[model samples]
Target: MRNFIILFKKEMKEGARSGKWVWLPIVLMVIGISQPLTNFYMPQILEMAGNLPEGAVIEIPMPSGEEVLIGTLSQYGTIGTLLFVLAMMNVISHERQTGALAFVMMRPVSAFQYMASKYVAQLCILLISLAASYILTWYYTNILFDHVAWTLMLASLAVYSLWIVFLVAVTLFVGTLLRSSGGIAGVSVVFLSVISLLTTLLPKYMEWSPGNLRAEASNILLEGEWGSSATLVSLSTLALSVLFFGLAVYMFKKFERFGE
Candidate 1:
């Protein structure tokens, strides 16, 4: 436990120093900002274009402030999720290639401890990224609406955090098994793409598969009934996260460090 804490702290320091935490928030900010910016200007932008000749003056209604905020969260939330997927898609492979793992492995830590610490570190990064996006969304929305559903928004953020963890676990598995970051990223994308294709082409049973979990959440947030199904999917995704992290640990154990 003490070793884990020490290693985790080391990981966090490296992440902070590398400006690694900046990418997701920056992408999310653009997404969040786009909502208000577009809502505020879109109508005027359309109106300024001198009266359309005919059948071209599409009636574009200005979005309500609340609606803008929700749109921001949903839209930017997805962009942020993709950014996280890209960031986490290279956990172990990069470390090994750059000799970063050698420094830690040489120290008296067991392979399990080392891998677990990395997993936890990735989890922390994902949580922080989600929290940062939530904060930005709340701040921006409050500026325009002056009143927001803090509880519901926060709950949504929490549920989405599980998805980030799941992706990180998949990343860890890829990074550990593959020797190159490009290889890891390529494999990850291919696997996810196949899952997505299958989910679309297959029957209802495959609908709730892991690849479709994020899409399901978006549906609930945007159009569907947020009932038992959402809760079930979130729980199932979290369980899969645990399983993937464990698989990462097992593979890390099989890895022969400091050798060919």
Candidate 2:
């Protein structure tokens, strides 16, 4: 536990030096704020850009706060996910390449402790960024559109957060298994894309998959009701994330001797 704490703090300091603490949250918050602002002013934006005939009326229906919030989440699903994968792709690989992992292993730290510390540090950053972005989105959504239920929003955030954590675990797993950051990023995106496709194509069969997490979160906002499978999905994703982390630990230990 002491080793985990020490390594976790080290990871946090590394993230700070990399500017991830500043840029990631800012980027996500910008994406969050932009959605509601754009939805609210879409009509005027179209009027200015559409080059419509003089005095021609354009009627654009304003989306509800729920819709705007869901749209913001979609942005996170794509661009935000990519950014996270790219940022974390080198977590293990770079350490291996630089002999940092060897230096750490020279101590009494276990592989599991090392892996868990990295995961927890990155997870903290992800949660903070998501919370900031979601809070800003919720605020703008309420001001620009109808009020979204606080309970539902919070519930959705919890579910979406699990999904993001699962992705981070996957990134760590790939980083441990692969030597190249580019390869890690590529495989991680493709793996997530495939999971998404499977869920979209077979929702009923893949209800237990983490891929359903994002849509389930959006549905909570849209319908204001939790799905019956919410518990099952949450449990399944959480288990999978742990499993991935364990795999990463094993892989890191196995590759440690290679010093790759």
C-alpha lDDT (0 to 100) for residue 11 of candidate 2: 98
Taken over the whole model, the C-alpha lDDT of each candidate is 0.68, 0.89
What global local distance difference test value does model 1 have? 0.68
Q: For candidate 2, what is the lDDT?
A: 0.89
Highest lDDT: give the candidate number: 2
Question: By summed lDDT, which 10 consecutive residues of candidate 2 come out lowest?
Answer: 251-260
Number of backbone-clashing residue pairs for each candidate, in the order shown: 0, 0
* Model 2 TM-score relative to the real fold: 0.96
lDDT of 1 by residue, 92-161 (tens): 7667778887777777787767777877887887687667766676676667554555665565566566
Query: What lDDT is reached at residue 254 by model 1?
Result: 76
Over 4 Å off, model 2 = 257-260
